[model samples]
Target chain A: MASVLASAHPQETVYGQVGDATVPLRFSSLDEEYKVLRERAAVLDLGGHGLIEITGPDAVAFAQRVLARDVEYLTSDRCMMTLLLDADGQVVDQVLAFGREDGILLESSCGAGARLLAHLRANNDEGVEIADRSGDLTVLGLEGPYAWGVVGRLIDGELASLPFESVVDTTWNGADIVFARTGFTGEYGYQMIVPIEHAADLWRQSLEHAQAAGQEALELAMLEVRQPIPRHEVTEGATVVEIGANWLVDVTKDEFVGREAVLAAFEAGGGRRTVGFSGGDGVPAPGTRVWVNGQDIGEVVHAVHSVGLGATLGLARVDHDLAAAGLELTVGGTEVTTLTSPYIVPKSWSIPII
Target chain B: MTIDELRARAAERQQTCSQIKKMIVSRLDLEIDPDWITDDQPLFGRGLELDSLDVLELYVAIEAEFGVALYDSEMAVFGSVSRLAEEVNPALRA
Candidate 1:
């Protein structure tokens, strides 16, 4: 036990491990005080992500062969957002792949980890290995407009020199870490990947930054960053000729597992159509029926108040004709005018300035 | 054409799939002939053509069926038909 303690790296910081989450900052909702925290300094603990480290001779190639996107030429300093699909071409998980000097770290929704590891093993005959760091790696999200400058101060310049999506190693208050310019919250953010022993130090450091800035309105400003921008939701079982995600298939990449089938689905058009809806204040729940022209068209997938925009926003797959923007849609049973969205545009923090 | 062959084939390919395959089965209240939903057959887009949400529902079904919480890291394994069957079938009996 003494050796174990000796081997553990220590950093200077504090973190709030709230609720029942195994990780920190995994809050159900940002606190009212965070409004002050977000503008100046707000760090969140993302508990739902399962962190997995991949290392082996064939790690890169094996991943390339199985996933839909190409990661063949990724640099250790970059990150790629990609998807994993079934043989039939349905998406299973959307992932962020961070390449490191020794290996690649994949972070995604917590629930899918076990199934993801199983898939890796199935394709593992070629000499790749997967390690689960869900317990070992503690992830912290430091976000805000001022986040970059503050993190730069903390890491002593390693943060500023690194561009978004890049990963670098540096010592923070005496603890060694893998600092990546990656975050789920769209901000000039950084995700500090640390050993569990050092989490408290890092958290404390972030809290210090927030307090020092005195801008306390950090989390409230972050609300503007919380809008749910609909990338695409896989609409299996439901026809999907028009939700716009059908365009996601890129044939130029390595022959994906479900290429021909997706192409075929594309050709057979007339699938269900999806549309965006922005209501006044009422947030629609998933599976809530949608109506158009006095008939049931479809239902809501995922919806939220869109903190970034202040309007309720959602993505709904409906019958073809009504999926277009400007088409009126009511909550399957209520009166709600679905507005076209820009709903809340994200304030750009990383604009290139000469 | 037969149930055992279909089951074997499906159980073989279920790994390359998302949850869509199983979701359709449940929502439609349909059962594989055990000869169908096989590996040799096309299950996702054609013949089966499962979409993304269906894949998610399939994820829920597998968990409910196997009694194991599926995580995102293991998604690739559940990416196919055969693979999911391997995990799901055993867990069903366990």
Candidate 2:
């Protein structure tokens, strides 16, 4: 409805760069990347994140017991989203888990590595050891259009079949790296972690490699760091399902922590939901309230200025009755209608690029 | 916002002073008598160990009776039923 109205606060986060490495933290640069990302494609260099390696005879069993998702079935080329929960079923942390020939590696929200390693150690039994590989590894992202092609050409073995959630073990650029097909852009992307010394070298190689491939080369562009505000949002644990990622939850995933509580809450019948809204053609900030027929039903979780679709689109968790795409909502005291259609893809891009 | 009104709303949600007290006891793993929770003692206080998140659960429970708007104020106060009555009844009346 409204344009990116000049907000009181400008999103001016810093971008760190060294010789050739950079982490785009500012919204302007990030936004430019998002634009390039939609039109052609771009590979961003994410340097601050780290990694953890879980190894031992009982690594899978140990991880499954402590993690909210079952990791026993994890193979060399697949990744799983699991929550590391305290006994109270409250989140200790959220992690992206994967397994390969050598060990089960977990990359998490940065703050989780030490706490998770200690948790396993305190409760560890036979044949389990955890190591913080954050110092040992370097992370790289092959995002944008030629991401898969560049990676696909270098690595062998069914790389093309890797889906949004697939993780594979492969030797690329003469070193071992865990390739997880996932990213934050809601597109086809991959996040690769390898030896630290090779990090800068691989980054320079990948960029050099992408430009030579004839597609719009990945470049240094900024994107807005907008989280879906995680449905859990710390304060509203289990309160997130109704809004941000309802599709991500598998109510059928056997018994798990907070499963019963979420189901109980579901039965009791009031979980906030994410709906879509637009003010003629303006974007609303995430967490803006949604009102309908004099009732406060939900809030916005994702918003985008769609250049492709030519309209402002958003994802909000709203009242069940008002969930239909055409329903109207009052956000920040402004009236707008919720629409389910997205500004970009006909399908959602939830997994990271591998 | 009155104690009676809140109690009535909680009652509609099938919650009572005893039930609320029992929940507070069990949820926090405390052993105090359910009766130790008084209508006037602050839901959170110098004597109470409940944190901000516990207050959120309490607010969610109370929302079943009065709408959540009762807590949306400039000062953001919601401590006890009686105090809540003093705080919200005026706003409702105004």
Candidate 3:
């Protein structure tokens, strides 16, 4: 699946294959685009993310059973980020679930749509209607400390300050769209779910106010904020506890698809836990060994040269007792220091929406 | 540091983080177990999803529990349970 706005993108845009979709990796240089995303606003072509709709008499019931969070009373004005866990408590995808009048709409993480769609269908014992809406509907995003200003110029200023995860059905340039105050990079972010026909136009108009950022820059920002990247963080046999994504799972909910397994893992405890580290010279591979004074504890989950920190940043899943921040750990041949979450404090944390 | 010494240091920080997590869960009336909260997991806006009111409650709770006043601290101090550990137990900042 290619982005619907690919034609509107500059000819020099770099594209990469991520899972089942061929998507833009960067519109410009990674450093440049990442700077734009953190300092100002950057437009995003999120069409690579799959949108699946669930509607039927048993729609809410089906969603309740599959979603990791409790969404029993989710109204049309709200949306949430939750994990789609398999029966074994492994994450299938991290999704943005929107409450709709009919039932619900799920936006899968980039390029994981096909897998998420298959999972939804296979688990459709309730016989709810599952429609893949990616063909007609696509998503665009604005993110940065000043992204709210872009929303004011492109859409409505009032929509810019809507509480986090607030969704509204609105019109943009005579096209009906679903606008939501959703963020991935911890910036003041908003997503516009527009029709594929009008997507190019919206993308072009957005480029006037914000530079286009692609998957590489977006994912980098997400990593700095310790956001869970399903593809990189969810290793084989790793439970939700090891992924440090317990916040996404509503353990209070009685009977969701992976609830029992997740709770058991939490109760059983003493598994490997993920922690952030920065100091290595080069970007280490996913399976790089993490060491403590020559004793191998675990391996790296994912890593990259972080534009925000100007250093190599990575997540290491180590023995549970060794996962806290501020410890000195070794990866490959270099010494690294374990760090706290949000390695780079988002400029939006200081900048207000107004 | 030797492996055993590093483990001891990590345990100290983890213990502080656990206490902070218990304070957050109890002060905010969250239902999840205190141990469920990871040291590096975020505490505001995304991970724990604590709001401004929850922040106020935590501010009061921290000063009462740890005898440390965070009234003048920046929002980043509450970035995570581990980050908060550094704040309440400054020894962990080493």
Which runs of model 3 end up more than 4 angstroms from their true locations?
A: none
Q: What is the C-alpha lDDT profile of model 1 across A1-354, one tens digit per residue?
A: 011111222332222321222222212233443443434455655434557777887778766766665677777777755566667766655566877666677875434555666666666756777888867766666765566666766775556546556777767767777787754333456777787787766766676674321111232232233221222244555322243433233445747666666556666755555555677457777788876455666788756655445566677766543443334457856555433222332232333211
Question: Model 2 residue A78 lDDT?
Answer: 79
Fnat for each model: 0.00, 0.00, 0.75
User: What does candidate 3's lDDT look like per residue over A1-354, in tens digits?
Assistant: 888888999999999988888899998799999999999999999988999999999999999999999888889999999999989988999999999999999999999999999999999999999999999999999999999999999999999999989999999999999999999998988999999999999999998898999999999999998989888898899999999999899998999999999999999989799999999779999999998777999999999999889999999999988888888989999999999887999989888776
Candidate 3 residue-wise lDDT at B82: 81
Best by DockQ: 3
Q: For candidate 2, write residues A75-139 as lDDT tens digits.
A: 87777665665544455555678776666887764334556666667766656778877777756
Off by over 4 Å in 1: A1-40, A211-250, A337-342, A349-354, B1-94
C-alpha lDDT score of every prediction, in listed order: 0.52, 0.50, 0.92
Positional deviation of A63 in candidate 2, in angstroms?
A: 1.9
